[model samples]
Target: MLLKVALLFAMLIQIGAAIIAVSLIRRTRFNGSWILISGGFVLMAIRRLFDFSTLFGNAPVFQKEEVNSWLGIFISILIFVGLIYIREIFNLRDRIDELRKENESAVLSAVIQAEEKARQKFARDLHDGLGPVLSSIKMGLSAIDLQSLDQQNKLIVQRSTSATDQAIVSLKEISNQLSPHLLQNFGLTTAIESFEDQLLGNSDIRFQFEATIGGDRFSYQVEITLYRIVSELINNSLKHGRPTLIQLSLSQQTDMLCLTYNENGQGFEPDQLSEHQGMGLENIRSRVKSMKGIFQLESAPGKGIHVTIQVPAK
Candidate 1:
């Protein structure tokens, strides 16, 4: 009795599965593969029903034994071919995904290159157009005869000359920022060290930068993206986090270049930040993604912040 019950249960399960496959034909738009698979399921369920009926002794046979054997073989062929078709569909989908990623990366690289070109143009305009104008003004002011002028007028001339000199200095600083000559001439490590040197005595924060690799050059995209990412992080810490110490390290392991940055600052809950907030973190993430790299950040309220970035060395 138990064997009969178990056989009936299995028949019901096979019948239900066949029903499911038939229903999916509509969703699959009657694709040939799904049609084949559905047919296979239906035949298998019919075979199960035949087996269940045999438990009752001398079960009715509507077809010859040879006919049933051929049907079973047909069902097996349908299922095998349908599964092969489904596997090919998955493979095609994966290929499409890879192409999409490559296209996105190419677009991102072009955009970054255009941005760098604009920066270079702007910097060149400032250096060539405005720089000499300020110098000419200072020279004209110096040529004035202070000896022939009254005391008050002499003082006015001196102040004007001093102000012109300061303006020239400020112009140079802005031009450098727009397009960093150091970064263009030197590699990543030297550029970072130079930036750290500029910030050394300006703030109370203790900044430490270490690079395990020296004078190693990478693709322009990799070096520039990393420099901008590091600069953004440091600026965020100074502007808001009030960190007393910031440490950064760069190293290369095998074919990967890794960067680690830490700040002992008043960190906040990362989850609390809205989509529009968080110190340009989304920008940083996009930059990392453009290079097919990884960006991981960790922080909590009062626990400080740490970040790790890894990209292909090539």
Candidate 2:
């Protein structure tokens, strides 16, 4: 009966240790607690085994018997406390993670909504300010050209025409940046391709883009969020990384959408930098968090940087 009780106690301690180990794996913050709990349980199990062996063997001497009994009680109490504390720590970690996720979702919703409002304001400004001004200039120039004029007046008309043309170009650029017409008319893939072509023509950096979209449609907010995020990433690469070659890949794997970018540039340690140090990276992180996505960065000194993001397909 004593042997069976000892074996049962040993099994319970082992079970507690197993549970603590699994919790440690899931909650990264409880590593030290797990180690202490696991060690204590192991010691208790060993002590119980020793106690069982002694009981089944030649009787222990008085001195050894008294020492064993005291040590066994001490170890058992330590093991029980350690297991309970570890469990409490695990619960705390889980709660923290849950709260963090909720906070991120709230922040993301605010950011995207704010961006949408800004875009609308910009579009309105272009239509109201630049659009009408350019139209008036074009009409006024046509009126001037129609009148009989000397060579000098013709040159003035030509200059006015050139200025109006430049203003039109500027307005077009502003409009495109505020809200890409292709994005509203067609879809994200086409808009991205158009932007890529324009970027490649203007910059010397070589960029490769691939899209393996699962479906033909996405929410307007999602499209805009992804567009801004990608734009920010590319801008960061250009400004900091100075990479000659950059690759961007987008695809859907099952129910998750993935975006990955790799650049051949000098990379810095992410842990070493403060959150506010890189506005571009911070923006990317915020955008990813808003979308309830997973963001990861891999980089080392003298090595290039790789950023991978995954979000659930909604």
Candidate 3:
């Protein structure tokens, strides 16, 4: 009698579990797979009810062989359906991850573009306003008649004129760096070449640029982004490392455009980018990721820095 009671209790618990499963799943989508799952649970509950009836009543409605066969078929169907449910869950998870990445990239891309627009506007303001004003001041100083002044006054005027000239030159250089016309008009390659030439001719720093790309240009956004990244790297190398030699390469392979840069100067920990990374390095990383491009950085304390980037033609 005790054994029979225990069996009845176990069967009741299983039926209850099945009822819960169906109720929960029914709250979700009603598809073929869900129907199979829900139906399997309902069938299991009904099968248990029939078994319970035999324990309490005089005779069984179904024979043991008949009940066993139905249970086997139902179990097989449930197993198959469970596998499909697991696979569907995995597929849905993968799709969600992909959508998340796309949304992140879109947000980052918008931020980088907004920053570029701000830089362009600020550059224009400097070039059109302060730059011209400074030049005019230099010219006015140059026009001053120092010959008619006393010796001490003439010397003061001369020194002031010299200072004004230097200031004008500095303003123009800063304005150009902010929004280079070459980058907008000539594309990335030529703009980079011009930058290299200007820096090399004026400063003691040495730059070697190699390009296998043709005159065909990337999209304006790509060209400008690449130019900004390169410029930041160059400035960092010059300011911090004082690297005597910097090497840059540009080439096209398959559907990708590649850039490789190396500086023969004291490098920093690549891991420290998060701690000490200024706007420049962070911007470079953000821009690359936003474009769905790959960026590789290798550096150590005593060694030099090497960076490689691969961006799609889009």
Candidate 4:
């Protein structure tokens, strides 16, 4: 009788475990391992039930054992209570993992913000401090009367004035590249288009920018991170990939903002890239993670490179 009770209790526990595992399948994202565990529990319960049914060898003893029947009922109730605790344990674990990711993202976001602040300060100082000083030097040169000077002095003054002008333009360009004023005043699309214009004027690379979201604005973090990512991608392509053509597209899908970039370049295997070759891609991945976004890269030797990123618009 005690043996029969033990078998019945084991069957009850197995069935309870099977139910719990099956219920957690969705919570575990239907993981294959969890599915197999659930199946194992179900098979064990079935096997135990078969053994318990045949324990009496058709003597009809199972129904006659009233004390064993009462014990099975008590065990079933205990297993039911235990399943609830098991589920709560899984929930607590998931919550802790979520909190950990949130903490990491928060730290990364803080670091990026601080870096951007530094860039802005430096750009502002260059524009406000050095910009005017260079302009004053150019103006003083412009005020010189070249007519009264000899031919040699006139030529020297002309060269000096031209060099000063070039220096002023180069300084402004540097300041703009460090911290884009258009990105601060205009939206992301406008800023990207402005960058594209500069590239088109300076390089042989054919660049394209398309935006389905028009001029809609996102959070500052999203805008700046995306802008930096685009810049880095282009720089990588020019310096290594040697791409003649680059295309970028931006769109809003549901609650997410999607970005797609491609370059017709000499691509290399992403998995086999050296540390220096992979660093840019890794930086892009980290930036996406900081925004809690998804980043995907596809590249192969001679196949060109493609990248996709999606982040929450909110």
Scored by TM-score, the top model is: 1
Higher-ranked by lDDT: 2 or 4 = 4
Ranked by lDDT, the better of candidates 3 and 4 is: 4
Per-candidate RMSD vs. true structure?
Answer: 2.9, 9.4, 4.7, 7.8
After superposition, candidate 4 runs with Cα above 4 Å error: 1-83, 150-155
lDDT score of residue 223 within candidate 1: 85
Root mean square deviation (Cα) for candidate 4: 7.8
Give stretches of model 1 more than 4 Å off: 1-16, 49-69
Please give the distance, in angstroms, between residue 182's alpha carbon in candidate 2 and its true position after superposition. 1.7
Report the lDDT of model 2 for residue 29. 60
lDDT of 4: 0.85
Predicted candidate 2 versus true structure: per-residue lDDT over 80-171, tens digit per residue: 77778778988999999999988879887797789777887898789788899899988889777435888888988988889998888888
The CA lDDT of each predicted structure is 0.86, 0.78, 0.81, 0.85
- Model 2 residue runs over 4 Å out of place are 1-93, 271-277
Model 3, which residues run further than 4 Å from truth?
Answer: 1-65, 198-205, 239-244, 272-274
**How high is the lDDT of residue 142 in model 3?**
80
- Give TM-scores for every candidate, taking all chains together and pairing residue i with residue i: 0.87, 0.67, 0.76, 0.74
Please list all clashing residue pairs in model 2, or write none if there are none.
none
lDDT of 4 by residue, 252-271 (tens): 99999999999999999988
Which prediction has the highest lDDT against the true structure?
1
Question: Candidate 1's residue-wise lDDT over 1-314, tens digit each?
Answer: 99889888988999999999999999999888899999999998898887776766674465546557977998999999999999998999999999999888778768877887898899999999999999999999999999999999999999999999999989987887777778778889988887777755677889888898888888877888889888888887876678999999999999989999999999878878866557488778877877888999999989889999998887
